[model samples]
Target: MTRSLPALMLGAALVGLSAPAALAQSAPMEMHAMTAAPALNLSAYGEVKVAPDMATITFGVMTEAPTAQAAMADNARRMQEVFAALGRAGIADRDIQTSGLNLSPQYDYVQNEPPKLRGYQASNRVTVNIMDLTKVGTTADAVVSAGVNQIDGIAFGLKDPKAAEDQARVLAVRALQDKARLYAQALGVELGAVRTLNEGGGYQPPQPMPMYAARMQMAESDSTPVAAGQLAVRIDITGTYDLGR
Candidate 1:
C-alpha cells in the first residue's frame, strides 16, 4: 500500500527529532570515560652517623711441640690464663666465644725424598665483645702479656642499631614527601594521598681497624692504643602520589 503525503512528512520529522536526543544522551558518558586519575613518582634517601659504644677483640694462642698432644696441652694452658685475665678485667662469660681451634702437623720437605714429620702446631682463637670502650687498650695489653701470639684485629660497633635505623627511615620519608610536593607544584597539579610506597636500606657493619702483626711485641712503657670511630646508618624510600588537576 502507498502512504499519503502527510503521513510520510510526519514520519520524517519524528526521525530527525529522535536522532539529536540520542546523541545528547551519549555525550556525557564519553566525557566521563575521558577523565582519569593522574599520578606522580618520587624517590629519596637519608643517613645518620653515631659513635660506636662497643668493640670486638679477636686473638689466638699458638704452641708448637714434638707431638700433637703436647702442643694442644700447652695451647690449652695459655688459653686458660688468657680467659682468667679477661674475667679479672670484668668481661662476662657470654661475651667470650671461641672462634677457631685447630691442630695441624708441621711438614719438612726434602728434595727427592718423602716429606718428614717435623712437629705439631696447635692454635685456639677467641672473639671477645668488650662493652667498655675505655678498656679496649687495656684489654689488648693484658691479652698480649698473657701470651696471645695472634691478634686478628678489632672492630667497633653499636650495641643497638634500631634507634638509629628508625631515625634514618623517618628522615627518608620526610624527604620523599618534600620532593613529591615540589614536583606537583612544578607540574601545576594538586598533590593527593600516597598511592604507593616502598622502603629499602641496609646496615653495613664496621670494618676492622689496622693493627700490628701477630708476633710484634708491645713496649712495656706504653699501653696499647685503639681508636673506635663513628658508625653510619642509611635508608631510602620510593613513593607514588595521585596528582589532581
Candidate 2:
C-alpha cells in the first residue's frame, strides 16, 4: 500500500519550519530600537597561580686571550663542560639550542689616548629548556658550577597552557553574563540570548619573574629563589544580545 502525507499535514509541517526562520530573517534588524537605550560592557582580569612546570636558562661562555684561536679554544672547552653537565642532568640534545655566537676584539680605553685593541674575545650563548621543575634550581646551580658565568635569565612557565586558557574563557563568558544582567536590570528589560560575541584579546601565558642579579655566578651556593607568581590570563569579549519585549 502506498501512503502519502495529506495536503493539510504537509502544509502544516512546511509552515511550522518556515515560521521561525521567517521570523528570524525578518525580525527587524534592530541595532537601536529600545527604550532607555543602555549599553553595558564588562571586562574581568583573572590570574592563575601555578608552579612552573618547566624552566629555561640562557647562559653562555665568554673567553678572552691574546689570540683568536686561544680565545676560541677556551670558549669551546668551557662550553663542552656545560654540555656535559646538561647531558648528566638528562637534558636531551633536541631541547638544547645554540642561540648565538660571536667573536670580537677586546678594546681598552685610556683617558687621553686612542682605544687600544687588547685581544680577541669569543662568546657563545646556549638556550636550554629543562622539562623537569624539580631539578631547575639544582640544574641552574650545576651549570654555574660548570663555568657558565653569564646567566642571561631564568624563566618559568607551563608546558601546556590550554587548561589555563579554558579557565580564562569561562571567566570571560561569565563576565559578559554579569554585564548583560546588570544592563537589563538597570534598563527594566528582560535578559536576552546572545546574538553576537567578539573576543578582543586572548590569554597571555605566564611570564617568569627574572630571578637574580645581572648574572648568576658559580660561587654562590644558595639555590636561587624562583617564585612563579600568578599569571593573569585576560580575555576580552564584546557580546550583543537580542532584547526581550
Candidate 3:
C-alpha cells in the first residue's frame, strides 16, 4: 500500500539520516572474538628403582679349521664341554637354549685382493637364563673355562615388570597432583576436575653395562668380577585441569 510522506522539518529529517555521534561510548567487549582463554596443562614424570631378579647371558663358541667337517667337529667338542660346565653350575636343560649356529668360510679382504678363502669358521650360540643373580659371575667364568670364546652379550633384567610399573605409576600420579596444586596456587585459583589425562608408556627394565670386549684370555680364571646394579622403572603422565575462580 502507498502512503503520503508525513510533513516534518527538513533539518530534523537530515539529522535522523546522518549518523549520531558515539558520545564517548565504550565498545562492548568482544571476549569471544578477541582471543581464547588460557588453558591449564601440566605434566610430570616419575621413576622407581628395583633390584633385578633375573639375568640373561648370551655366550657362544667359534671354531675355525681348514674344512667345514673339522670345524663342526671341534665346535661339537667345545659345546659339549660348555654343556657339562652349565650342568655343573646347576642350570637346567630347559633354561639353556641354543639361539644361533652358523658355518661360513673366512675371507681376507685387501686392496686388489681376490678374497683369499681362509679357513671355515663355525659358531654356536646359547642363551643362559639365570634365576639366581649370585651365580652370574660363576656361570660366566665356567662358560669361559669350557671354551666359549665369544661372550655375545650379558644383561640383567627383571623377572616381573608389572608390579614395578604400577608403583611408578603411583609416583607419577602424585607428582602430577603436586604440580597441579602448585600451579593452582600460583594462579590464585582452585584446581578443579581433570579434563584430560594421558600416560606415556611406562618404564623399561634396567640392563647391565655391556662387557663386549673379548675375554678369550680368561678361559681358565678363578672367577670374573661381575656387578649387578639396581634396575630402574619410570613413569610419565600429562594432565589437564579446570580452574575455579
Q: Highest TM-score, which number?
A: 1
Residue pairs in candidate 2 whose N, alpha carbon or C atoms collide under 3 angstroms: none
Which 10-residue window of candidate 3 scores lowest in summed lDDT?
19-28
Most accurate candidate by lDDT: 1
**Candidate 2, 1-245: lDDT as tens digits:** 13555777888999999999987876566433544433344454434444557788888889899999999999999999999999988889998999999999989999999999999999999988889877777777777778887777777767887787677778778877887888788788887777667776654534434547533444565665555555555566777776655
lDDT of 2: 0.75
User: Which stretches in model 1 have alpha-carbon errors above 4 Å?
Assistant: 1-38, 214-216
Between prediction 2 and prediction 3, which has the larger lDDT? 3
User: Which regions of candidate 2 fall more than 4 Å away from where they truly are?
Assistant: 1-46, 203-208, 213-225
lDDT of every model, 2 decimals: 0.88, 0.75, 0.83
What RMSD does each model have against the real structure?
A: 7.6, 11.6, 6.5
Q: Could you tell me every candidate's TM-score relative to the true structure?
A: 0.77, 0.73, 0.76
**Model 3 TM-score, all chains together:** 0.76
Clashing pairs in model 3, backbone N/Cα/C closer than 3 A: none
Task: Residues 1-245, candidate 3: write the lDDT tens digits.
Answer: 12334444656787676644332232334444675444589999878888888888988899999999999999999999999999999898989999999999998899986998878999999999998988888888888888988886778888888899999999999999999989899999878888889999675644435665454345454456677778778888999888886
